[model samples]
Target: ISIIYISSNHIAAASEQLSTTSQQVSQGASEQASSSEEISASMEQMVANIQNNTESAKQAEAIAFKSVEGIRKGYDSTTYALNSMKKIAEKVSIIGDIAFQTNILALNAAVEAARAGEHGKGFAVVAAEVRKLAERSRLAAEEIDRITHDGVKIADEAGRLLSEIVPEIEKTARLVQEIAAASMEQNAGADQINSAIQQLNQITQQNVAASEEMASGAEELNSQAQQLIDIVSFFNIGERETLKTLSNLRNDTRKIAQKTTTPNTEFWKSKRTKSKPKPAEGIDIKLSSNSDDTNYERF
Candidate 1:
């Protein structure tokens, strides 16, 4: 029974300790679950954002491609236009030369007409009119040549600007393509992260479940401890005092002997006295209460 009582006491103490530890574990599990849930939510949002950014990057890539194509077309047209303008300038220069030569020929013809005298008057009049027409043509050709040269300068500058812009637009398209690719990679990474977070949440939930089971086990242990205490309570062991020494045990034994041995001792004394002669007159015969006295033999 003492062993049972001690065991119960130990089990109760252990159960209390286990209950505290289980409560702590349960609380920690709940906190971990909450944190995991929060992290999962944040990961989902991040994955969604990554997906949106990937789409945006792809759209930007397409737009950049279109811009590059348009720029290339403009550059090509500018080149063609520039070449045509140069050809027009050349043609205008040729026209100016022809007009100048025509003017010189007309002057020579007029001189010949003057040399012919009466026979050349009509030819002279025609030659003077041709000279006037040639001079006007020369002036008009010079004006057209100047304008064409100006047009050619403007077209050449436009072509040079288009040529310079083409490479930059192509570079921009390449950069956009790279951005789109990187965004796709990032989106994939985000998906992996999201999956990891989900797994973490699952583990956290498992931990929570385990913690709850531990808590229930702790409660059962506590109940067992209480039942042990109740079962031991029936014995009325009172206080659990320690003896610790043989001397103390002897003392307790002597005390119990004194309380219980007196009746037997009195009966023995009466028997011995009755068998013996009575003391005479005023002399009294008294028995010693010294419990350790073993000198007298039993009757």
Candidate 2:
């Protein structure tokens, strides 16, 4: 019985400990589940941001492509305009040469008219007017040539700048495309991480459920152990009562035996006293009934 009691106590203690540990585990699992859910939510948000970044990168790439196209077209147009300016400048130079030749011819004609006399007076006035017109034309042609040359120079410089810009724009477009590709890859990675996190969250939820089950089982075990302890306590009380009753019975039997034997001892003493010989008070008594008896013996 003592062994049983000790065993019950140990089992109860172990059950209580197990219940406590199980409760702790359940609580921890619940916390972990909550944390995992939060992490999963954060991962989802990160994935969304990554996706947005990917889309933005794609849009930037498209804009870069469009810019490259526009730059290319502008460069081509500038080249064409530069060529046109060169042609215009050449034509203006030719016009200036023609004007100079006309002025020289007009001057010679004027000198020849002056050599003629009064009949050449009218011709001399006409030659002077022609020379003046030729001089004006030459001046105007020179001015036009100068303006065309300046225009050509400006066009050439613009074309050169456009040529430089086109390559840089192309480089920018390429870089933007790479950025878009990287963003897409990063977005994909984020999605995968989010998925993993979701799976982890699910596992954590399972753990929480399992832990709760374990805790419940532990609690049930603890309750059973408590009932067993109660049963053991009842048995212990019964065993103690049995021992006490046996001790009391033994004591009562001993007392009864003592009470019953005490009267027997007194009755035997009275019988011996009644059987004892009485002695006369004034006579001297001598006992010689047997040779071995020399003196009277006390009963």
Candidate 1 Cα outliers beyond 4 Å, as residue runs: 112-129, 238-299
Candidate 2 structure quality by residue, lDDT tens digits, 1-299: 43455567778788778878888888898898888888888888888888888888889889988988998898889889889888887887888788888878888887888888777889888888888888888898888888888888888898899889888888988988898898889888888888888888888888888888887887788787777666554432344544555565577567556556567877567557745665631122232344232221210
Q: What TM-score, computed on C-alpha atoms, does each candidate reach?
A: 0.73, 0.76
lDDT of each: 0.77, 0.76
- What's model 1's overall lDDT? 0.77
lDDT tens digits by residue: candidate 1, 177-210: 8988988898898889888888988988888888
C-alpha RMSD of each candidate structure in angstroms: 16.1, 23.2
Clashes of 2: 0
lDDT of 1 at 299: 9
Give the range of the ten consecutive residues with the poorest summed lDDT in model 1: 236-245
lDDT of 2: 0.76
